[model samples]
Target: MQCGFAAGSPCEVTCTRVTLPDLCGHLFLDWNFSFAGLIVEEGASEWQLRYAFYGDGDAGWVHVLVAAPLAEKTFPSIVKFVHAADWHEREAEDLFGIHFEGHPRLGDFILHDDAWQEGVEPMRRKFDPREAMRHRKPDEDWRPHRIVQEPGAFVMPVGPKYSGVTESVHFLLETVGEDVIRSTPRLFYKWRAIEKLAEGKSADEVLLLAERFAATTAFAHGLAFCQAAETVCGANVPPRAMTLRVFLAELERLRQHAGAIQEICESTALAVANAHAGICEEELLRISGEITGHRYLFGLLTLGGLLCDLANDACAKALEKSQKVLSQLNALEKHLRVSSSFLDRLEEVGIVPERTAMVYGLLGPIARASGMVRDLRRAQPYLGYENIQFDVPFEEEGDGYARLRILFAEARQSVRIMEQAVGALQSGNVRERIELRAGAALGWVEAPRGGAFHWVRLDGNGKVARYRIIPPSFANWHGFHLSVEKFAFQDFPIMLSTFDLSVAENDR
Candidate 1:
């Protein structure tokens, strides 16, 4: 059934409350079990109650908040009803401080303990950051630890520095013989607080910060942030810009996925496959630079529309290069798939089941590799993706091999999308001058990792009020825990790298 809520309302009240089984049944019918949970987000004030219905899919999840004051007495039952939505409830409790009476695990989801005083809610609107900082100290207790072991257990640590020149992240692996007992990831080493710094900047300025959230997915972040800003201003982008945005977004996917597949090859000691994949990635990056003047495709998107129009000839040249690069990459991927050594390392390593993926709300390639058919580009269409045709890849094995194959398949699909988008590109105005308005809006884009979300609110004078960015890395971090449970210590690096979790994106 279609929701009857109007566009302008902050919340919509759904009188019907179904049991978990019935809710799951409804989700299966409509969104196809993409998401299966309920949550509650209270208003800023003490008395206002709002409930949210959250659903998960292989691609991403959706949240719809209902307007109504939640009865304090009923909060416990509500919390228990959606036990699978622990992270969501914990986040709501931490930010809004709306107690989930029966919540099994409720604590700070992101904030360090020293970052906020005990019993003080750091994310609430009324909490003063300066005052909180006064009481805060750097949390040195943020190190990773493993389980106590008998004779067979071993501990392995991978990187504050890695083999490749990449961002800094560390993984702690615990194993007994060849089976991994636990894996713990340590993040926040690259925390920039981009959301906090964006407080007083103009929407345009925040767009710059958004682009830097991740080097690989820069265009994706810029696109999502710009869409949020445009939504807030009620500005409509020109069709040409929209088409170009889709083109760049797919291009970003191609580059990132190519890099991922190459890394997987390198991990499995397949030198030939790795070299071939690396060459394809460099070519993809070069094509990005040819099309947008930046290898990473940053600064192409702005608040109203594109920073500048694309040259038609440049677009054509980039398309031709991409087609050639993709063909070569496809041949290499097929060869790697048949290689016994590579298959041996990936086939059953770092397995994450469909049920666990759902509990952790894995997104993008990770969730797709686990037999989940979720693709935000298809599920919640934006940036002309609704008009474009593509398939959501899925793997039933849910192992390192599955994730690797998914990335390879997605790279091919992204190339297909780029080809179509480039063919349809028209020579026309790329931007429409839009007047800024003081309002709030939500924007989301399917970044290479998963869904990158931006919530932008503008002040009366056209300045940013509050900017909340929830990158895919933050949501998928839970998958690390789920995947590491039964894997061996040596497999941790491959498993971790397979997800390609971006610490910079998560820390921001």
Candidate 2:
């Protein structure tokens, strides 16, 4: 049934597989909605594919559901109309063996062909993890696909393995000369299947998995999961708890942006700038540890609210230290702007056009850097963000410098938000007792890199039945190649550092 929807309420409509693409196009292109994420779930006899969307300004969410029969598990691909569904379609196909009829590419997505067998379908009901592990075989005939096919063109494989603490992600940079003509990223080298693991587990058990999946953005993901669970159980959070949630969220954002700036500085060989940014990042981590008792703010978020109430003095102290760090970040930004060498490498290199960002559904800072002013905190205010006063920083240039400026701007704004949240703190219960019930809901947050969406469904026993995470890195990774393409090979790392996407987030 189709119904009028409010900003937070979802209006879901059931449609046949035949009219799936047209309906998706109608809602997305004609109605002007942003493709949020595609969620696929297996039922008793059929597969349900839900196409989720969110709109700007006063608009609400619209979900299109298509049921593909088990006899012939197939559905018309919506990638031709909505380009953002590319990776999502591939992931569903890989895990469930549900073929998207017109999908251009489908195999070797989460389950890499070189490592996993062809028809394992780990997400299927009949499949067993131990059984699959006992009989493992790598596809020896596997070869990386190439797009650039000129006389002197050759593909340079970067890595599924790299030096330092970087996660495994192979990059196929196809080039004819000095310029990279095509760039293909092969991620999910370490797919932990967190979603698959969440099946049948209680909400509390799954919360632990959610936070650990992406350590860098732990609080954001954990909070999102908690929000979904709270919504499912119809739990109400106290105003003070809501205020603290925003405060902690901004703290994570502040630290993440500082780390991003540090990486960008290191990428451009700015030794002093790198050290200064790193120092700021370390200080923020220390502050996080002092406040939440965890360096990454884990073990703090629960079903309806926070695990513990933060003392007023602790909040004040953290805010003061964060303000000093912001000032240092501002000084660093000013110095980098005057540095000609840094500007030359970042100014126009790796540009993602505004239209491309919109079509690809780029989220968070990456989308904002391209002049797309879509932030969930402001657009769909949640967790007391509606009461907070701050600006959603954006840039029209969409270059490396634009991305860098966004990081700094957002970091400053995060401090401003933290101040407001801390000043408004009240003495009360930080958490509400929530009795779990069977339901499904979507929870979202504007993380440091971009918007992170978590869709969760609970069984009758209050255990997780279906869990889907669409992290900012996963959404932004699609458009990452657009920036790398046509840019010189020398600017690759600099361009990548600007995005600051998490490989661990994608692998999950």
Candidate 3:
């Protein structure tokens, strides 16, 4: 049954009390899972609240929900889980007014305008929305990850706006001579409280919002959102629809990978390569528009199936476009590989060790490039992925070069997947008529960047009581500093390009 109904609804998540955060480690070790989230939820009674620790597992996600009876203001921290917990926990402290006892840093993460007004948690319902949106005071400048100066080194701040990618993210690079001593990223400038805005939307309307989560992976995000709704509603997507969805998703992967590959070329100053890759990318988007009627395939996915069937000639054009894009990418890959100077700029520039990748739970090509084979497409086969035969290309280099190669390899694989999926389409209904009732479900898709996770809770009327979307970049962004460690100052742009992360995705 739907255990809880909204804020103050009994938590649908199973509650297990851990009076001490230390005990969480015992359960964590026994369960063999990693921390996915930590949050403080307003309890049914005003005298209490809850601190839930989410653990992601293969069987299903399990959360240890700790109830705090308002007798305590400070709760234990899980930074010991890994440094990754630091970000999520800090977010909890900032937005929920909950304090973490041992968190190394517990200040403004996503919420602050120069500084938060004393005694008011913007996320709390009691807080005035007008105050939250109040005009910034003169001389009050908000800088997310303010740069720290190194005694003998100079600190350089890169965009909260970088060329090529339209997002806000600040990067602090400390340089001594030509080598970078350190790098720190400040994000969330694009934060629109997407989850908060989605709270009252119907399940169908939320699908549209999901597609806007990240422009780079619109289709991937939409598919994940739909999957969660479908799961909760027990809607069986027909085989033909599933196959068509697969085609659309893979097409998105090819396009995004091409665009990222092009960005890398821009950073490396390969004008010719960048132009050609851009052309390939545009062609892919054009193909998507032809088949799904939206360049990003935004309107194509629905609760039970696609909004409609692919046009009769859609498959033919998709195949032709994919083949063309694949050939262009192959040529670009060859050019970069043979260019000694280009290869030199990329090789060993930014190396994130395999151990570090796993410790931080890195995702997508970043993890794959570091010798971690954790692509969910193969590991947790969702949708029609289990029906398709494809390869997930990985590399051991863990450097800019390896990341570039991985992008190219993954794009090639996307092309192969699209071709196979197109060939597998059969005649069947494309949409299933089902009602979204009160329930909750978790769904995810291996987006081009990495695994995008969506958790949805529907009210009795099928309106979204809650929806949390964690784009892959949200997890992948943490490992960025590790990749750039000990790299030269001039390589910063190139290294960043290799990752091609979307600050908007993480910021949202």
1-508 per-residue lDDT for model 3 (tens digits): 1134343122344333344455446444455444444534453453222223233324334445566565466767766755556676777677667787778777757865464455556566465444445533634354444344556767677876666645677777777667877787777878877777777788888887898878778889988889888888888999889888888888888889998998898898988988998899899888887777788887878888888888646796778878987998898888889998888889988898887886676789988999978677776678757777888788997989999999999988887887888777888889999888887766778898988878787889989876777677877888788777677777888888898898878887
Q: Top model by lDDT, which number?
A: 2
The superposed Cα distance between candidate 2 and the true structure at residue 116, in angstroms, equals: 1.7
C-alpha lDDT of candidate 2 relative to the true structure = 0.89
**Cα lDDT of model 2 by residue, 1-508, tens digit:** 4545555578888888788899898877788788889988888898888898888657767888887677778788999989889999999899988888899988978877777656878888777655647334665676898777789999888887754666788899999889988999999887889998998889999999999999999999998899888888889998889989899999999999999999999999999999999999999999999988999999998888888899999999999999999999999999999999989999999999898998898988989999999898887788878778999999999999999999999998999999999889887888889898998999888877788889999999989999999898998889999999998999998998999989998888
> Which sections of candidate 2 miss by over 4 Å?
4-8, 130-136, 139-141
Q: Which pairs of residues collide in model 3?
A: none
For all candidates in order, the CA lDDT equals 0.71, 0.89, 0.75
TM-score of 2: 0.97
Clashing pairs in 2: 364-450
Tens-digit lDDT string for candidate 1 (48-125): 332323333232333433333544423342434333355555655655566656566666455545465666655555
Q: Is candidate 1 or candidate 3 better by lDDT?
A: 3
Query: Whole-model lDDT, candidate 3?
Result: 0.75
Residue pairs with backbone atoms closer than 3 Å in model 1 (clashes): 34-56, 34-57, 35-55, 35-56, 49-69, 49-70, 58-374, 59-374, 180-487, 180-488
Rank list by TM-score: 2, 3, 1
Off by over 4 Å in 1: 1-4, 7-11, 14-63, 66-84, 92-99, 114-122, 126-166, 170-178
Report the C-alpha displacement of residue 245, candidate 3, in angstroms. 1.2
